[model samples]
Target: MPGKRPLNAAIIPSAKRERKAITLDIKLEVLRRFEVGEKLSQIAKALGLAVSTVATIRDNKEKIKASSQVTTPLRASRLTRHRSAVMENMERLLSVWLEDQSQRNVPMSVSAIQEKAKSLFDDLQRQQGESSQTEKFSASKGWFVRFKERHCLPHFKVNSTSPGSNADTYPDVLKSLIEEGEYTSRQVFNVDETGLYWKRMPEGMFISVEEKAEPGFKSSKDRLMLLLGGNAAGDFKLKPLLVYRSEDPEALKGYSKPNLPVIWRSNKKAWATRAIFHEWFTYFFCPAVEKYCAQNNLTNKALLILDSAPCHPVNLSDLSDNVRVEYLQDSTADSMQPMGQGVASIFKAHYLRRIFEHILEATDGEDKATIREFWRNYDIVDAVDNIAVAWEELKPATMNSVWKKIWPECVHFQSFSQTDNIAWLQRNIMALAKNVAFEEVVEADVGRLLQSHEEDLSNEELMQLERERAVGEGENEDAPPALRQLTTEALSVAFSHFEAGLQILTSNSPDEEWKFKVSRAINDAINCYRELYNEKKRRSKQLS
Candidate 1:
């Protein structure tokens, strides 16, 4: 809440109004009340809203007025027309880019787009009087930049090795498997390491013009590293990766601490040790791979994908003969990696959600947390725990069901050329949009259905249950039996919702009937525990 800013209250034009009718109405009502003599508090109370809503409405109104009024008097029509044309062209370009994001077929480079926009202003100057195209160019440039930033970026892919190498060549063994049609539609398990930072600015932090910082306002100096991995399914398994800073080249000689932070000013021991990589491989990567293979009944013939990180050893002699590592091209992960495409994003989203929930819980329903204390005390162990819980909550069957809807024409074990792959990706993305639309419909219906009974539990009871479930067990015997009962009930409810959502999203599939059974189990568990908790609560109320 410390960094929170007021929302905008400005009225947009007719076209914009149609695009955001509900939001526009809310903003208008807030602004209308604020314009009256009523205080912000009174207006918020009248509207059944937070006072911050009034503040946002006022801020937005000011921003709209400021942005709409041109400082230089050049007929407003000309500026509006130009802006409209620029927006239309941008939308057209975006459609083209989305259709084929091969970098070669995209309409214009970033520089070319800027130049074309600049030239529009130049043309305007020639038609009217001499004026600085700087402001208009800047505005148009910002719009195009945002458009590209949002919609035009290439898909994320992770491959083994760097680009321009033969590391990506499918081995003869793999080719043979493909030819035999043994690898078609089979699950691909990809393992990679990524670093997570404590107190790092989250992805997509949008700062507006008013709040824009001067250059060099922030530095990436206080990042903490975490190593994480997942497969095609968006599951995450993470471990903390250590970092050391030193100017000295030889200071590594006496380093023996497992989690020690070492710093050296002189060039005595600056080079990173190979032992660190070996340690990660032995303690984290190897064990995870082995365990996963054993648990999943994956034979040695399953495809394993990895990047060319320096820490990844060149030789994998410890792995069985049937297991082979497929190296990806460098810098091309945005195109080939499943984790880069989906899993990593999902993991990061789940991580941030958990972090926000934790912060809210710690602050006793307050949204603020001491940033420094959060970073210092934020244990990677806890983060891993959160991620694991979220992974279990993932509805893989739902995703696969959705994928099947979109790629109905897809054939397995076919050698899809680059063009074929691109077409499939386009179709798949389109299918995903439809799938989400269907899910949104289901979510809306569920919301309506659950609205009446949603308030059966008190806020305090829910929070207490959540906390006890997270902690799992008490260290002291003094802990109340009711608290443990509530925890069990809450966990059952949580898992029930998770499983129910999966069931709804996946609907009916012979292959996925097990999911429905799981959901039913969770529901039964919740009902049993809730009955126990209700009996306890009733007894406590009678005693009181």
Candidate 2:
């Protein structure tokens, strides 16, 4: 009654407002700013978001970063809690098919794309055996629009009316981009995948009939995928991205994964999957490029060139602000991808040579019996070591020269051609194979062995791979066997030996300073064991 005397004194109620949504791009920027010591309140103010919202975004940085890789319509501001795996996989594969169709110049319509989407979704459902309960997907106009947005595809002919109508103009496109961006050889990179049958020997090594008759005797078909890439400059070779069928192979039980030369990952079929590729891009590739830029005093911005592989996510550019991803024209990869331009062939040559070297080292002039024994015991760890050594053997000049076909300006040396290098490696491999008692192994056989990796898997092989895929989906992985623990008595004896060795070194030393340094280093090295020994002693005392 008192306030009613004046309209200005009347209390008014405010309406509740809907929450604002943050896009992946904005979130990434916020994180970047926060990382560089920007205040949360300031970031919030700059981005027109609440301080609490900025803080929340910071707290969920990891999930947000991961979502950046797999999410669709990456620029969309709406917050999507989850997307089905089937849908994600379907879209990725569908994108690949669309690209393939485009490459072939096959005419495509809206209806055709919808039909293809439906077919792909159905195929995925059947593969997962969830068709019965799964909701029907119509692949309607809304979905098509979203899909296009997600893959950054424009409204245009997804296909052509005639074959070869769309000429391989990727070379010109890349040249234009290079010039426009003013990028040097070091700023441009290419990546590609190849198959590695780690345990496979050339078929020239004849298998006994009994061995052939044994179950699962197809060792040559036991394969893993390796993703190899380096900058056009060839001075920077990214660590090999190796994918195997098993997460923790028996052969690698005691190995520390982080310390391995290759970035190891796993897929049920040992094929390159989108998830693995995403991991490689975000964790390995980006960090590697960043490190390279910092060391070379170059700009952080980079251009990563890739083929239209199914494993590669289309929205990779959204993941990093400084990196731009460009795909080669479909079917032009073999002709234009720097990795395909003798880089992979050269790598295979190196790997094969390393394998033969391993045999030589193990059998010492390749005694057949010793070689056979070594081959039988050879495991994934051995393959990884060989791969590491082989990768290390690739010289920068060789890497730089491989780009001659794609970016000739990057090439500084032409003294050694890929053909010459490969022939030399093959000749060495052939000679080594003969020493290993496989005199029938020819250069052609080695070439075939390399090409065999590209062949399609047989029906039986696909079935086996599918079973593994199922196991992985079900998360029924077998645990690696635990190592035998050292007994207290063994530990005590080891410590005694270590102390005795230190005392012997002290007594035998001529220089006091050198002796002290040596003794201190040895003691420091054994400190971990010393702690373990003390722990065991304490436990024994407690038991008494």
* Cα RMSD, each candidate: 26.6, 16.3
Residues 251-346 of candidate 1: C-alpha lDDT, one tens digit per residue: 245544333321111111111223444455444455555555556676424445555444355565354344455555454333444444344334
Candidate 2: residue 231 lDDT (0-100): 90
Question: Model 2's lDDT to the true fold?
Answer: 0.74
Please write out the lDDT profile of model 2 over residues 1-544, one tens digit for every residue.
3444444323333365554656677788778667645578768877899998899999999998888767666444454334455666667667655643443234468998788778777777777785434657889999899889867864444443445622355566778998888888899998888777787767666642224556864555578889988898888999999988777888899899979989888765566767778878876788788778888999887899987766788999998887899987654565667777777777777888888888778878533547667777888899999999988888888889878767777788878688888888888888877776776677887888777665544433444554454545545332321323567789778879988988898899899998999988887766655655787789889999
lDDT of 1: 0.41
What stretches of model 1 exceed 4 Å from their correct place? 1-187, 201-220, 233-287, 296-301, 317-319, 365-544
Cα TM-score per model: 0.32, 0.58
Instruction: Report residue 353 deviation for candidate 1 (angstroms).
Output: 1.7
**Model 1 clashing-pair count:** 33
